[model samples]
Target: MKQICVFILVLALTSCEYFNAKKTTPEAILNEELQTFNWNDVDVYPTFSECDSIETKNGKTTCFTEVLTTHILEKLQKDSIVVTQDVTDTINLKFQVSETGILSLLNIDTDSLIMKEIPNIEALIYSSLDSLPKVFPAIKRGQQVKTEFELPVIIQAN
Candidate 1:
């Protein structure tokens, strides 16, 4: 009984150190070297909804779906990249936001009559990413979620 009590006491004391050693310090987590994304001026339309909420970690804000769509559309228009086709638009982009608030492309689909200028269309998406806002609420529970951003790039002559 005495030996059991001694062993338990020693285990308890050593366990603290073990846990501490395994834990990562806040500084280690916040250091620029450890960060994956660098936030810049990305134009994102932020929508506040039950599904959308702001996450303020490391002094940064992430926007959600509808707002992101609006922001992207605005970006495309600002660049004057008009779609020179009068057809059905079917383009979808699926990507993930890194911990540091950078977009990492997961999938892109460009299969539609509307996409005549494939290369330019792609460029528009990439260019707009800089101003793209982060998804809000930070995808609870799951490590990843599927979010789609669709656009119909149409060009009309004056």
Candidate 2:
């Protein structure tokens, strides 16, 4: 009886969390996962309806960029911008797509010469986005998330 009692006590003590076991709760596990999650990366990049047909990841990004560039180029082409001294520059546009699929421009970086040549360039770019194809928010861990992008657009005029 003494030996059985000692054995049982040892088993119980070792099994208790104070000795060895640390029970993992759902909340704890979730918190741990959140801490390790990469917020900057997404499983699926944000895209437009026009790019929905693309099956590959790279294809989707390319299509998204092409569609956006085409829209902006079309808008700029209509303005008949005239520049002297063969102006050539690149506009680095930074923007965000909200989790709700709404787009907002954060900033536009361009040469001062380009700004002077195309006085309404910023407004034109903003306005062009107004009519872009429907946007879908990026997907991360099966949840829609906001994403930011920096796209470069070249400006050239003779």
Candidate 3:
């Protein structure tokens, strides 16, 4: 019918105009500038095991350790009810630091909450790690290297 034909034509024109009116702004264009450098691009320590080169003094720890732990705790607390509940039990996250200075969270000890909030645990780990500075040194062949460590974060309800 003629009415059906007209309806199809109007829809085609409307869709064309709708798509044409959409424009990317300058900020979006600038954000796409691939040359912009980020720490991830040039990060030396690529993983937790790669952090073996990072020397840990007996009393002197890296300045970033405390700050990074605090950030991770904050993120977990925000997203995890278990963390906020002040549970006396602890959950251990085992990970390896690659040579690239990136800590790969391999496994999480499943507490009641961790099993319940699987997505939150994954997001909290990634979000907290985004702000950490990468500066892992390389390990020597003869020297004993320690690239992996544990952080027992306490979950307390306030």
Candidate 4:
């Protein structure tokens, strides 16, 4: 009877371990967690200095846009770049805001006509962006993350 009881106890212990064992490897679990994370959405959007007073999401977004637009327009006016011929086009500016609130230009998309008319247009845009105050980068899962923005700049010359 003593031997039978010992054997039963051993079996019970082994079974418990088997039941509690992990079915998936650690790497697999990590991959699953990463896959579940949504890349498109962030917990908090990037903010500019003028947008600090805004409380609502929509209000902040509008303020940010307005501040950036005003900065760019002011810079362009200061440069006084002349277009030989009347032209109207939209320039697409792509930039990334780093976790430390630094803005880096990624790319600028403009038609050939605009490029020819304003050879230093790219430099002007970069200077305008750099002149703005630092921005708080977007936050994801309670951590700051790099975020990208694509802004359309319309240029109309008469």
Per-residue lDDT tens digits for candidate 1, residues 1-158, read 99999999999998898667576777887795536543332333222343334444322333344455666667767765445554345467776664344555566677644355444767777777776544442332333333333333333312
Question: For model 3, how does the per-residue alpha-carbon lDDT over 1-158 read when each residue is reduced to its tens digit?
Answer: 99999999999988887677668999888778645634232222222333345655421244335545676787766663543333454667675665545666676675776445453665667677776656454343333233555556555443
Mind giving the per-residue lDDT tens digits that candidate 2 earns over 46-115? 8989888889888988988888888888888887776766878899999899999998899999899988
Better of 2 and 4 by TM-score: 2
Q: Please state the error at residue 106 of candidate 3 in Å.
A: 1.5
lDDT of 4: 0.84
Each prediction's whole-model lDDT (CA):
0.52, 0.88, 0.55, 0.84
Ranking by lDDT: 2, 4, 3, 1
Reference-based TM-score, model 4: 0.77
Backbone clashes in candidate 3 total 23
Q: Across residues 13-132, which tens digit of lDDT does each residue of candidate 4 receive?
A: 888976785678899989999999899877777888778888887787677667777888788878888889997899988878899988888999999999999989989988888778
By TM-score, highest first, what's the ranking? 2, 4, 3, 1
The numbered model that scores best in lDDT is 2
TM-score of each: 0.44, 0.83, 0.46, 0.77
In the order shown, what is each candidate's alpha-carbon RMSD? 11.5, 2.9, 18.9, 4.0
- Candidate with top TM-score is 2
